[model samples]
Structures are given as C-alpha cells and as structure tokens.
Target: MTAVLPATLAAVDLDRTLIYSAAAAGDTAGLEVVEFLDGAPLSHATPASWELLAELAGRALLVPVTTRTVAQYERVRLPVVPRYALCGNGGVLLADGVRDPGWDDWAAGVAGRAAPLPELLGLLGAVAGQPWVRTVRAAEDLFCYLVAHARDAIPAGWLADTAAAASAAGATLSVQGRKVYLVPAGLSKAAGLLRLRRLLAGEGPAPRLLCAGDSLLDAPMLLAADAAVRPAHGELHEQGWTGARVAVTAATGAAAGEEIVRWLIARA
Candidate 1:
C-alpha cells in the first residue's frame, strides 16, 4: 500500500485559476476590469466548484492569492466566506476582512529592495507608443500593465527589453493573457505564502502545499508547492509543465477550477 500523506494547505490563484475573468476569448462585453460568473454560461466558476471549495475550506486553509490591489479585489464581491486573502501581488494580506499588520511589515521589507515605479513607468511609456499596445494602465497599487492586442502585436524583443529593464531596477515583469504586469521581484506569491506558512505552521515540519495557476508568473509558487495543478491552457501549459506533481485539467473555465479542487481535496 502507498503511504498516506499528511494534511495540506491549498494556495489558489483567484483570477484564471479559480474565478474566470469576465473577458472571454471572443467576448468583450464586460471587460472593463475583470468579471466573475455567478451562473452564466461563460462563467469562470460553477456550483460544483463552490461545493468543492467549501469542502476544502473546511479541511484546509483556502488562501485567495491574486495580483489585484486590495481595493480592486474588494470590488470582486465574491461569496463572503471566511478565508485568508493576499491582494496586490502580496502587498496586502487580509484575514476574514481585517488587514493583517505583519503583512504590511513584509511588504515594506520587499518594497525597500524592489525597483521604483517611476523607472518601470518610463519603460512602459515607451512601450505604450508601440502599435501593438492598445491601452495601458496602472493598478491602484501603482504596478503597471498593458492590454496588448495579441502576442505577435509587440515585438518579442520588447518583452526582453522590459525584462532587462525591470531586472536592472530589481523588479520583475510578466504577461498573462491580454495583460502584462510589473511586480516587485521579492513581493511574489510564493514569498507571501511562505510568510503565512511560518505564522500558521511554525517550526514544525512543513505540511504539503497544494497550488494551481495558469501563467509563467505562477511558476515560482507552483514550483515551491509540494504538489501543483494547471489547466490545459495558459502560458504555463503552452510552454509545457515539467516540475512537481500536476493535475492536468480540461481547458474550460469552471471545469478546470472544479478539477483542481477535486484533485487537491482528494489528496488532502
């Protein structure tokens, strides 16, 4: 018989990983910011997903990790269940609606080393003039990102240039779906999770960490997990997934999220 695994924690990406963004491949009716499906056909989540998440919520801590700023995340208005949340790419941490002070300390420490927003904005300004970029905007938190027309719209070298510039400034940049983001190198989802682990798990041997996402930006958190899951689509899937335990899911939105929860709950 196989050895049984210990209890585990599930760290999930909010946007593409759990909830579907309002912007569908062919549909742009509600792409103002980001939209979530409550019960529509193109909705990113389904009833099954809610049931599964509720189950996991009971068994393991379900952390909603997203790049959206704390205020932006508030606009999401997800079903209010008690769960820890990390918003603004780990810039702010909240537990059951209250801001956690420790996370602010961690954010300050990370920001102290990251490149300033001015430098990144300058590069983005140059890139914005390119024909490929339709619109660019800064998050309420001051991070920069752009809505590009397509992958081929911008020269591949532009991504390289941005990465190089970000590197020089000690920052990190990534493009996911139609949007690109400039995040401080040290303020990553993995780092935020580690801080939570330290607070909750303490010095005891770490419990298995289960994570899932769909972008290269998610690679660090996925790699750090004891087991990880990904959908058949997304940047990570296109490049091929090769590390850690993985659950390959269907390409559809809610279906993929349901599959991830199923896989994690089964393992737990």
Candidate 2:
C-alpha cells in the first residue's frame, strides 16, 4: 500500500483544478480520460497530473471538494479513491462512496436559513427557455444553475440583478464559463472542509489543510486552507484574485492540473 501522510489533508477541486473538459484542456496531447458521459470521454487529466495525483493521494488525505453533485462526481475515475469527498458545493458529502446522512442534515440546516430551494429555482425560471441558455436545472436540490451557450448573448444587466436578488434571498451567484451557479449563502466548500476537519479531529493531530481550485465558489475553501493554489487561468485568475497563503500556478489548463497535483505532493 502507498504510505499515507497522516497529518496532511489536501482538499482539491476537480474540474479545471485537476481535471478538464476538451474545451478547457488547452493541450490534448498526453491526456488520459478520467470522466465519461454516455460511454464517451467527457473530462481528462494530463499525463503528468495522473501520475502525480497517485503520489499525492498517498502522501495526504486527498478529499475532492467540488461543486459537482455526488452522482456527477462518481463519474470521475481518479488514480486513487478518496475516503472522503464533498460534492454539490458542500451540499453533499460521501464516505466510502456512500452519501453521509449526517452531512446531509448539516446541509439541510444550512439551506434552511437560505431562500427555499424552489424559490431559488424560480428565480432562474426565465432563463430556462432563453436561447443563450443550454440547460437550467437544480443540483442535488440544494442549488440551481444555468448553462449558457453564448455568454455575450445573456441579457445585459440580468446577471447583476439576479446576483443581487440571490444575495437578498440568502443565496449566492457565481458564473464559471458556461455555468451559472445559485447556491445557498452558507453552503460552501470551506464549510464542508471544516466539517471534515471536525470529523477527523480526535483521530490524530490536526492535519495541515492544503487546497486548490480555479473558481470563485472555491475562494472560500482556498482561503480557509493553510496554503492553497489556483491555476493561472479560470474564474479566479480572470478576476485577478490572490490570497496571502494561496499560490498561483505558472501554467494553465491541463498543464496547470499537473502543477497543482505536484504542489500538493511537494507541500504534503
């Protein structure tokens, strides 16, 4: 068995952090399929990332903290199976591939204080039939999102107004490329990471928290980490976000994923 790092917890994001879709993955050469949809490859990893991740998983408690739902996350076949994972922006947690009921309860409590899910969903109902939007759906019933085909085609001022409305409703809005996420204000990846920390508290000394991501939603988790990293591109990079403890990768796209895994391994 790969020797494990008992005092290092690496909470990493998947998409654009360690995995990438064809459109987001800059160079396809030396890429390996990590996710599939309908029997076709949908997401991929750099050859170097795939190799480094195996080592990182061995050196730390690598928990994937992603906005993907549990069902969607299961589609990714990583080099190692993480014992703990946070999905749906911390709306769901999984242990050994099974959904954790207590985590669900915690998520419910967080969501309860926000606008009702249906109300949040209703806020985006108008986009369902808009030509710019490709899909409009609720995620794990804790959040909603809209996939857009053309960013410029989105009606002007609608996003800002919607974001403001979401804020007023105790919800938050984030735009990541084609997807726009509307999540409960307090339901964050950082919160899930904290819960994991609490669950692991008495097992041993507190592990050092390391994180990586490339999105605004990931900001909280990254900030909460002892040290974090973000790629040179993506939502956060586009906005020029940086933190005292967060490092920015020199590479972008698939190569950046490789760099991130390497960072975790080096730090761990």
Candidate 3:
C-alpha cells in the first residue's frame, strides 16, 4: 500500500463517476445518446449529492481528474468550477478553469520521455495482427485505443503481454469495453493528483484522499486514495472494489453517479 498522505483530497474520474456522457458504450462515444435525444442525459446532481459535493468543496479541495482534453472537458461542462482539475490523463492542469503555468512545464518535461503517436501506431499495427481488431482511434491528446469485435480473438493473456511490451516502450495499455488504450507511461491521473496533494500538504494534516472510477485504467487513482467508491458497472466492479467503501448503484451510468453523491452525503 502507498503511504498515507498528510493532507487529504478527492480525485474523481469524470466519465461515469460524476457525469455520464451521452455515449456510454465503449465502442462508440456516447454522442449518439445525445444526438437522439435533444442533448446528453446529464441530470443535475441529486439535491443531497449536490449538497455533499458542496460540503466537500468547502471542507477539502475537489479535483476533477479525468482523461479529457481541456477542449473536450470544456464541452461537457460541470455544474460548478473545481478548485483544481487534471485533464487529458494528467496532460493538463487547470486551477479554477484557467490552465496552470507550472503544469505546462510539468507536461512538457514528461512528454519528452513518452513515445510519439506514429511510433505507437506502428506498434499497434504490428502486434494486433488479426481481423478481430476492428478500429483504432486516438482520444483527445491522451493516446490511441483499439476496438476489437471479437473478445476471444486476443486472449487475456496475450493482452497482458502486449500491454507489458507497450509499457516497456514507454506506453501503457488498458482494455476498456471493446477497446485497448495505449497511453504514455507518464500519463496517469495519480501523478497529477499527487502533485496537487503536495501543493496543499501545508494547509493541514494531509487530507484523506477519496476517489472513484470505472475501469482498470482507474485502478491507480483508486488505490492511491485514502477512501474510495466504485459503481455497479466497470472493470473494477468485476475485480471487486478495494477502496475503503463501495457504493452499489443502479445498473445505468447516470444512476450510479447519483449513488456516488448519496454515498458522500451519508458519510458527511
């Protein structure tokens, strides 16, 4: 286990954690859900959940740590501004909606060591030698993910080995839904979150860290928190949640978010 910190904070994954995008399916961005209806299914945070988040906002800092680029993040829109945000899998840091200068230097320093997209694409093509591998696309400045039509096409063991190979080459591979992400080894929600925690350590005994996420990619952040929550669905659910507490919510993504808010309120 990582050492407990001196100050506490909440590091939450945005999609399916606090907000459910229109595209809930892994193969397709939730865009269709929004397009079919007039807009996406973003119900306002339940009153109790909103109150709890507000309480956390005042008592301890709330950071929206997500795998979204600043531009994409700007589009979904949040109910309230967070004190700090880690965007694009820690590629960018924002303080009160404005990009932080220090983080720019940090991103540049880290990006220098990561593999470029062209190299990553080549590796993906070389290793993923099968017709089952249907589509591959890049996420907003984070990295590329491959969608497979046949789950049995690549054995889980092969996926593990492939991920290890990618990591050795300075990238990470995380399978979510029908896709596998090739993220830079340096890009993680935990890295950016630890940086924010360090900045606030002097304020009080390191605040307890609380986090929530849906996939294996989120495992690092979830494990790093002082306490955490996991929804009914997601890779973490199948493996079981190791956080201090787990919230079993409705099967749907939007309903799970409501459960998260309720969990905070009950504890608060």
Estimate the TM-score of every prediction. Answer: 0.83, 0.95, 0.73
Instruction: Give the root-mean-square deviation of each candidate in angstroms.
Output: 5.3, 2.3, 5.8
Model 3 CA lDDT for position 143: 69
Per residue, candidate 3 scores C-alpha lDDT tens digits across 1-268 of 1243323466777666666534442223322221122354532333444446666665555788877678767765454678678887877888778998778788766755777776776666765567788876666545677778755576687687777778877988776556677888787888878777776665545667778788776778877876677778766777765564544566456567657766654443
Error of 2 at 40 (Å): 2.0
In the range 153-189, model 1's lDDT, one tens digit per residue, is 7677878888888888878888777777887788788
**lDDT, each prediction:** 0.72, 0.88, 0.66
Q: Show where candidate 2 strays beyond 4 Å.
A: 1-5
lDDT of 3: 0.66
Q: What value of lDDT does candidate 2 attain over all alpha carbons?
A: 0.88
Off by over 4 Å in 3: 1-8, 21-59, 125-142, 147-161, 202-204, 241-252
lDDT of prediction 1: 0.72
Model 1 clashing residue pairs (backbone):
none
